[model samples]
Target: MELEVYTYQFLRRRSRISSSRRRKSRSISPRRLKSRSPTPKRHKRRKSRDSMSLVSESSSASGGPKENKDDSEILKIEEENKKRRQQEAELKLIEEETAKRVEAAMRKKVDESLNAENIKLEIQKRLEEGRKKLLVEVDAQLEREKEAALIES
Candidate 1:
């Protein structure tokens, strides 16, 4: 009666038995909602009622085509499962993207700090070299002045 879409998620394994039978059976089979497990007599009474319903269905089947009630339930369960899987997949993708963004931010912060430390070390090295050159020049100037004073005397 209706068309369905195909997806890779449906390609994976699925349960042979549909859980919707128990999950939504209240709508499909109301009589099953009430249980009389503690009382055997009530259980037997329910079984008899079930048998009577089956007998009527069998007679109707003989008179005409049997209704595909079970088939509709199976379709509904399949759709429910697919929708749940799609939502879960979307959530997983979102989580992975967030984690990647955090990792990239952390890497950028570490690289920035490392570059700052390297620049500080380079400035200190240049300043030390300049101080050494000035000390050497001052020592040469003092020796020249002393020689001049001795020659004049």
Candidate 2:
């Protein structure tokens, strides 16, 4: 009985130690893990900015013209890219202005067509009214002539 109790207590203590270790590991932040890790690629990327000046200095020490040529080429390329961007922006603006002008012209044409249709309808209405007035006047004249002829006879 004594041996069995001691064995159970030992097992419980071992489990408790393992659980505490797991809690500690879970509580550790990512920053601590990154600091512990060896990331050579990240270090290389950070060193490249310093390396560019070293390369230029080495080229100058060697008395080479390549460095100046490379710099001029890079500047030329950057200028060309800037010019292309400006041209593209100008073209986009022109296209937008043209689209606006076309839209305005279309709207004006539609308005003019509508106005013309309205004028035509108004003219037709006036002609119809004039025809009715003319028929009434002719009927009154015929009636007056008939009464005059009857009185004379």
The most accurate candidate by lDDT is 2
lDDT (0-100) at residue 12 of candidate 1? 23
Deviation from native of the Cα of residue 40 in model 1, angstroms: 47
- Candidate 1 shows a clash count of 0
Give per-residue CA lDDT, model 2, range 59-101, as digits (tens): 7764446757877788899999999999999999999999999
lDDT of all predictions: 0.67, 0.75
Candidate 2 Cα outliers beyond 4 Å, as residue runs: 1-64, 118-153
In model 1, what lDDT does residue 80 have? Answer: 94
Q: Rate residue 118 of model 2 by lDDT.
A: 81
TM-score: model 1 vs. ground truth: 0.34
User: What is the per-residue lDDT of model 1 for residues 41-96, given as tens digits with 9 covering 90 to 100?
Assistant: 76888888798678768656544223445545667989999999999999999999
Tell me how far the alpha carbon of residue 102 in candidate 1 is from the true structure, in angstroms, after superposition: 0.9
